[model samples]
Target: MTDEHRSGCPINLSLEVFGDKWSLLILRDMIFGAQRHFRDLQKGSQEGIASNILASRLKHLVELGMLTKRPDPAHKQKAIYSLTEASIQLVPVMAALGSWGLRWQPASEELSIRAQLLEEGGPELWNRFMAELRDEHLGIPAEPSADGKLVRERLQEAYLAVLAERGKSLPSKA
Candidate 1:
């Protein structure tokens, strides 16, 4: 981070703010995936970060105008967080990075499912999904889910099952 930069490059500034590994993960959680609170981000990430690191990253992101925090009506003491337009606009960046990871970096078949979902679904699906996330996070109108249409829940269930299997099938995976 100490590497000096003189001129003003937008990309350079972006990387300076969110170029690190964990910051993007936080964005991924909020925008593409389901994450609202501190605990959710920590539990869902594969690269386990300490509690202090997670707190610092959250604070950094808030300061960067990528996220906003609001008081939870139900829980007076706790704050429920959501993404700003700046962060939600990172959908393309998220899509590109996911595609890049699947291409160059070999992740598990299960891990690749998320990438596949975004890649195969294209922009329309991604936009709709992000719209739903925006609605939920912003405390706006939320679309009602079908009786049994559990998309993320199903994926998470499968991921948990994969964890329980624990190297039984994915010997080549990281």
Candidate 2:
């Protein structure tokens, strides 16, 4: 929708919208880390995104319908960004990418723990995660089940456990 594509390829079309590192990283923070505010996304970013780049990618994602932005009720000047259903569906893709990264790239244990859990959890876990996302971002009730661990909570727990093992304090939740 931003511009005419060179081809009708699906991958190419996806790349045009979210191919860049920053955009995906932004989505990752929103999906996994539950960062909704602009400052939270900027500061909580492990990759240390610049202010202008974060602004641009946020705008681009909104334009592409991957995200929606609105004024934060608690903070008059700040905006809250939420993932659209289209972006919510990217959970599996993110999991695959994380799995690949864990295999091929050097990743810190705490950072890559979610990927490990997701790879081990497979599709069922991904579905639960998507359900949880819908609950958080869309105000839909999460599927009723006996499984007590929300995917986000489990990932945070894993991260905290790793940090505790290393004698590090858990970073304050954003």
Candidate 3:
């Protein structure tokens, strides 16, 4: 439905919205890393995204209906970004992409751990993750679980563990 579609092809249409290198990285941070603020996204980016590029992509994503931006209640001058349902549905796509990357690319173990877990866990894990994302971004109640290990926490723990093994501490929060 976007005016910028190059063709009727589904892949082309999807690429039109998120084809750029930076957009999906931004979404990945939001979806997997739970980084909602612009400053956090810029500073915490493992790929070192430029500030201007991050700003532009955030605006583009909001315009394309993948994200919503609203004033942060805790900070008057700051904005909080949240994923829309469309972006939430991208969980499986991201998992698949990560799976492919892990198989063929030279990704580091710490970085690829989540993808490995996702590929192994399959749809059931992805569904739980999507449900958690909805709870975080859409204010919906996440399904209750007996075991309290959140996917996000597990990923972070893995990253931290790698850092610990490397004798590198987590970066100080801004």
Candidate 4:
């Protein structure tokens, strides 16, 4: 990014930080999949992000205060990345983007289920999910759920169910 933004608009400022697909994807992986380590982020990428690009983006994110990186206790050579409070506040944005994709794009059922559920759940789910994110990344306590299931767990379960149904119905390779 340039030293100066094109405009002082909030949207413009946000775009400066999240304008590229890779950056958003990195954030998405961290937020949705909990992929923290460099290798995990690279492997979790659906779009096959190159190592150089991933490394560049990770460094950029850390520099921009979206993520924090430190030595991993499990492996001395590896680093653990954590989302900062600023990035944790992006759950609603992700949900909105997913919702828009589901409505306007030719998204598959298995991939679109989480978006569908998030849109259906609306702000309530978004708030709860954000709370859970805080719990995971920020060490903030999450609000207790009535059913004892996390919002993430619920979202993952829905995605898996859709995948299972799709697998059963799709023609198998011969």
Candidate 5:
């Protein structure tokens, strides 16, 4: 099927890329789950997105300019996919979705950082995080390279810290 989508409204335009369950879920894994590659996405969710679906989503997101795949410096077979400005802009959307899940969803207690995500970093925090991401990804209002860290690297670092705080180690690099 051809992707003849409505460009009338910004929301419709956005839904063209992120309308489906798997698409946003894939994006969420990138944003919230620290998923930079296929394996990171595959292992975490209990709902178990099929590999074929996952693969398709990855490609689709990349095609729509939401993600970019870079050769993984650490692994031969793996490619590290980072969110582009398009995808990073979805941070607020994700934060709202997360807030909803935390509030009404019955599976609240099982979530790893429900309290932090919901209270400590709701829309305001999501915006700040997105600002940092935009500054890093799109070079918005450019900042000095004092740290040499990109938005992608900063995000990965933050995810690792969260994992460490929860008494887990970053999954060993393969």
Candidate 6:
């Protein structure tokens, strides 16, 4: 990473951190799919990211402070990746991008359901989801919800419902 930046604009600065084609998608997999290992991320990506690209992006994201990588205690040769606070704060941005994609892009219904809920739920949902992400990733406690179900669970349920409606099999989380 170099100190040289094209411009001082916020968008430009943010893009410098994650402007590449693969960075945000890697973050998306970590956030939505809970993929913490290199193999999981490489295998789970719908776009089928190549191993070298995945490795390079992971290093870049960690260097940018958007993610953390630590040795996994469970496996001797494996490392676990986790989203950092900076990346967790991108929920709204992700929501807005999803909303735009859903509006203008040809998106699959089952794949786009979470974005739909996030769009409809608006800031309220985004805040709650961010709180959840903070709790999960940063060890910050989020206030208890009235309904008790996790925000992710609700999103997953909606996703499953869409898959069921389409008669598609559930994709393995592994």
Q: Model 4: clashing residue pairs?
A: none
In model 1, which range of ten residues has the least summed lDDT? 165-174
Which predicted model would earn the best lDDT? 2
User: What TM-score would each prediction reach against the true structure?
Assistant: 0.76, 0.93, 0.92, 0.92, 0.68, 0.93
lDDT of 1 by residue, 1-174 (tens): 345654478898889778888998888876645778777777767677677988998898898888888787988776777888788778767877888999999787777767767777778656666666667666555465565443456446666567666754432212
Indicate the residue-level lDDT of 53 in model 1.
89
Q: What would the C-alpha RMSD of candidate 2 be, to one decimal place?
A: 2.2
Q: Write the per-residue lDDT of candidate 6 for residues 1-174, one digit (tens) a residue.
A: 346988788899999998997999998888877788999999898888999999999999999899999999999999999899899888899999999999999999998999999999999998898888888878899997899987888999999999999999987644
Candidate 2, residues 1-174: lDDT per residue as tens digits? 445886678999899899999999999999999999999999899888999999999999999999999999998999999999999999999999999999999998888889999999999999999999999998889976576778899889998899889888866544
**Best of the two (2, 4) by TM-score:** 2
Kindly report which residue pairs in candidate 1 clash with one another: none
How many clashing residue pairs, candidate 2? 0
What are the lDDT figures for the candidates, one per model? 0.73, 0.92, 0.90, 0.88, 0.70, 0.90
State the lDDT at 154 in candidate 1: 47
Which ten residues in a row are the worst by lDDT in model 6?
1-10
Instruction: List where candidate 6 sits over 4 angstroms from the true fold.
Output: 1-3, 171-174
Tens digit of per-residue lDDT, candidate 4, span 22-71: 99999999998889999888877878889999999999999999999999
Cα displacement (angstroms), candidate 4, residue 159, comes to 0.9
- Lowest summed-lDDT stretch of 10 residues in model 4? 165-174
Off by over 4 Å in 3: 1-3, 171-174
